[model samples]
Target: MDYRVAPAVRIAGRCRVPGDKSISHRAVMLAALAQGESRFDGFLAGADTLATAAAFRAMGVAIDGPQDGSVRVQGVGLHGLQPPAGALDMGNAGTGMRLLAGLLAGQRFGVTLTGDESLSRRPMARVIGPLRQMGADLAAEEGDTPPLVLRPVAQLRGIDYALPMASAQVKSCLLLAGLYAQGQTCVTEPAPTRDHTERMLAAFGWPVTRQRGRVCITGGRGSLQATQFSIPGDISSAAFPLVAAVIAAQGEVLIEGVGVNPTRTGILDILRAMGADITLLNPRDAGAEPVADIRVRASRLRGIAVPPELVPLAIDEFPAIAVAAACAQGQTLITGAAELRVKESDRIAAIASGLGMLGITVETLPDGLRIEGGQFRGGTVDSHGDHRIAMAFSLAALRAPEPVRIRDCVNVGTSFPGYTVLMRGLGLEIEEA
Candidate 1:
């Protein structure tokens, strides 16, 4: 599948993107471990999130209706999950596979977790090393990549470990495993990452303590309690439309009910630094996360040196940031983002390649990219089967003189389903081909 996006004339409307993907994944996982039935409103029904729900179902948890962003999960308690019939396929979700590995480490039965090609290629050593240190009998296919095989461990001993880098997935994985370990497990990160896991853990009645950069949880201390939750709109998914509104020839766009957690607002911060006219309205709590309405208007963007400190917070949205960079007035320098190399694709290279095809001057660096602001010409770009790359290129069309054709876009549904329809509703000239 591919996307053909014509030049956008004006981007004006009020709309909402899908629910936060990270929160949706965690919601389903934690809900399945809680003691009773939990209802979730605004659950993302995308392929990646559904894969998490399916994995729980395979382990005998009953999950109903993700229809219209509503889902009911009947949790089987922390230790009540039944052994699956076979290897659990996580499809395209790296988050699901890593977190599930931790949750399943202390179980009595053996399990194997696998994924689609892209996910299978992602580095798992970050999560694997800590899990192994906790006494998990697990091995990856090539020492670092996925297809994780785990044998039942009679007991896991928790340890205070510090991450070499900041990673929400790795931290969350260890915390989940800490739930069953013999002692308290503490993790310290050099930089702060997303705290959805910590917040969700507390929401489920699990006691989690945080002091500065460290989060700690004691094993066998408490049980997860069922609770209702309402997920906020994904800022990652909202990035494309936000960039569209920023670079459009005319108009303003209001994106409602978006998650504005301080940790995940790097994209907004970076864009604002680049002179994007973005504002947050109606700030309030949506369950454990913060929600707000985003108002963005077309503005003259000026690129600047992106701070390395903000890299981890905006890691997933860099592709969209690249589009905004290309539409800016000067140059944008990105660094300290080596993590982008291991995502669903080599995002730095992928973004550079796609932008170059559109006549943008982009110089690829090992950790990041040096993008020069310039006009975009109509061209065809390959997404390398990465959903974010595909969507980012689609947004680039808003500033192009001609239509942009993005190939290998079949994977967009893994994160954001109904992308074309949603963008169209906001007046972007986009369609599936």
Candidate 2:
């Protein structure tokens, strides 16, 4: 689907985005590993997360209703999953495929995991190398991509490994696999990443410890007990409207119950540093996660050199941040984010191409993009089947001199379903074409 967005004078509304995709995936996986029924509220009803629920069902676990902010998972014990009848399809979810690969590594039966073209192109060697060290019998495509073949391993030995990059997926994959491995498993990251995995583990009654840059877990111990909890709204999703409100002519948007986990709030920190008038209101705990109401109003934003240390923290929000940069004063330089090249699309190149198509002066770097803040003019841009690219450009329309059309945007459903509807509600003119 293609999305057309027209310039808007103002945006005003109170909105709640879907559950955090990371937390939603973990909630389902951990709940399915528990021995009893677990009820979760605010589950994200998106294609990626639904793939996870379907995979669990194929393994003989029963999951009911992701209907209207709730899901009930009847977990099979840690040792109870049956070999799936055929290949497990993860759709567009890198998170689902990588994390599930680790969870299935120690099972007695073999399983094959596959995904859409985009996911199949993503590198799986990061997880493959670590799992092999833990003694997992695994194989991948020639390029170390998808169609990963995980054979049964009689025993998994724990190891103290260091991450070459700061990745929550790799860390969580190892930790989940650690649950079935023998001895203690420790993963040290070069920098801080999202802690949703560690937080959700504790919520499920499995204890983990984080000291400095490392997270350690002891495996082959107690079973995970089922628990009921609610997931906080995704801050990643809120980033669009937050940026939209900041760049709009006159607007105030109140986003409710957004997860403000310190590690994942890099976008917020960066926006504030760039002089956005954003406030966190009525902060409280939502289960093991922190939730707050975010109030954002239109402000004359000035470009600043984004701190390199916050790169991993705000990695996912860079596309939206690029939109803010396009409309800010002066220039914005984003560095230390070579990881952007390997996402669903080559995001570094994709962002530069898309923004350039809209008449913004963007220079593509080997690792990042240098964007000059100015006015956005209407034109057509390809999303390259990237959800963030599509959504970011749509927000760019708020400041466009004419309507902007984003193509190949059907992949938006992979993360934020009904994104067009949400944008339309905020007084922007958006339509599917």
Candidate 3:
């Protein structure tokens, strides 16, 4: 499928994006391991999250109704998960696969994890190396990619490991494994990544300790207690329309109930640095995460040098940020984002190529992109089968002189199921093609 987005005269409205994908995945996984039935409101009923739910169901956990963002997960306890009938397919969720590797490592029965083509190519060595350090018998296909196979280990011994790079997925994977390891597992990160796992672990009644740049958990020390939670709106999904409001010629947009966790607010900070008129309203706690309503108005954006320290925080939202940069008044220099190359797609290259097609001057770099602010000339761009790339370009259409056609956008449903409808509701001239 493709998306054909036409120029918008105005972008104005109040809307709420889907629930946070990362939190939804963790909620389901941790809930399944808890001792009672846990109910979740505002869950993201997207393909990737549903895949995680399905995997748990395959292992004999009963999951009901991700309908209307409501789901109920019956906990089977940490040691109660039954062996699956076959290889567990994670679809396109790299988060699900990596975290599951850790969660399943200490189980008595062996398991295999597979994914769709895109996920199958993502590097798994980061999680694998840490799991190996804890004595997990895990292996992957060549290039440390997926088709991950694991064998039962007599015991998993926890180790204090430092992350070579900041990764929430890797950190969460190891911590999940720590739940069953023989001793305390401590992970120190070089920089802060998302703390959803740590927070969710604590919410599930698992004891997790946190200090500056470090999180530690002891194996078999506590059991997960099933608890109810209401997931906040995904800032990553809210990013596209937020950028739309920034670059649109006229009007304001309010995105309500968004997760504004400090670690994941890098996108807002970067856009603000670029002169985006964004504000947070009604700030409050939503379960274990922070929630706020974000208000943005059309503003004259000026591209600025993106700080490297904020890279990990805004990692997933860079694609939309690139669109904002393309429509800004000056050049935007992005660095310390080498991780973008390993995402669902080579985002740096994909965005660069897409912007170039729209008559934007973009210099592709190994770690990032040098994007020049300029007018967008409508054109067709391939999404490289990446959901973010597809949505980012759709937002660019708000500032285009003509319609923008984005190819290979079928994957958008993996994260945001009703993207076209949601964007259209906010006055973006978008539709499925």
Candidate 4:
């Protein structure tokens, strides 16, 4: 699919984005492991999360209706899952594949996981090494990439491992595996990453201990009780419109029920540093996760050197942030983001190339990008089949001099399914072709 995004005079409206994608994936996984039916409200109905659901169903867990932000999973208990008939196809979800590796490591039967070209090329070695260290028979492709094969293990032993880098997926993978391990499993991160796994574990009645950057969990101690909960709006998905509203010529937008978890609020902090006019309205908690309404208005933005410490926090959001930087007043240097090179697409390269195509003075860096703030002239660009890249370029249309045509945007459904519709409703002129 391609999107021709024309310049917008104003973007105004109150919008609610889909439920948090990360949390939605974890919710389905955890629920599928529980002893009984687990119901979820405000669940993300994206293609990626649905892939997670489908994989679980193939394993004997009965999941119904991701319809209208609600899903019910008839869990098969910790040890009740039947071996799937064939390889679990995770499609384009790196999160589903990696985290499922942990969950399947301790299962009684072996399973193979494969994906599309984009996901197949993603490095799986990070999760592979850890799972192997924990005594699971696991192997990846020659380049440490995907088509991960896992052989059933008699038992998994818990280990205290420190992550070489800050990754929520790796941490969550190990933590999920810990549930079936013999002893206490601990993961000490170099920096704080998203705590969706820990938070959801605790919400499911599993005890999780966190001290500074280290998180520890004891396996085989308790059973996960199936429970009901509401998922907050995804702040990551909200980022495109948030940046669009920031760069728009007029009006304000209120994004309601957004998950404002501290570890995941790096984009908010980065935007504030760039002098974005943002406000948090009606702050509260949706279970352990924090929720708030985000109000952003048109503001003159000035680019600043984004802090390294905040890089991990806003890692998933850099594509949109780069769009904001392009519309800013000065130079924006983003460093400590080497992780961006390994996402669904090489985000740093994709963002730089796409922005350069749109007439932005962006210099690609080994770790990040050096973007000089300037007006964007609409032009043709490719999304590299990455959802974030596609959406980020759509936001560039808000400030573009002409219609910006973005290609390979069909993958946008992987994360934010109704993104173009939502943006169009906000008064942005986007047409699908």
lDDT of each: 0.93, 0.92, 0.94, 0.93
**Per-residue lDDT over 1-433 for candidate 1, one digit per residue giving the tens place of the 0 to 100 score:** 9999999779999988999999999999999999999998998898899999998899999999897999999989989999999999999898899899999999889999999999989899998899999999998887578899999989999989999988899999999999999999999999889999999999999999999999999999879999998999999999988999999999899999999999999999999999999999999999999999999999999999999889899999999999999999999999989889988999999999999999999999999999999999999999999999999999888888899999999999988899999899989999899
Q: What is candidate 3's lDDT per residue for 202-320, written digit by digit as tens?
A: 99888889999999999987799999989999999999889988888999999999999999999999999988899999999989999999999999989899998899999999999
- Residue 104's C-alpha lDDT in candidate 1? 93
Quote model 1's TM-score: 0.99
- Candidate 3, residue 380: Cα displacement in angstroms equals 0.8
RMSD of candidate 1 to the truth, in angstroms, is 0.9
Can you tell me which runs of candidate 1 are displaced by over 4 Å? none
Q: What lDDT, from 0 to 1, does candidate 1 have?
A: 0.93
Better of 1 and 2 by lDDT: 1
The worst-scoring run of ten residues by lDDT in candidate 2 lies at 362-371
Residues 183-235 of candidate 2 have per-residue lDDT tens digits of 99999999899999998888888879889999999998888899998999999
Candidate 2: residue 268 Cα off by (Å): 0.5
| RMSD of every prediction | 0.9, 0.8, 0.8, 0.9
**Location of the lowest summed lDDT over 10 successive residues in candidate 4:** 73-82
Candidates ranked, most accurate by lDDT first: 3, 1, 4, 2
Q: Judging by lDDT, tell me the better candidate of 3 and 4.
A: 3
Off by over 4 Å in 3: none
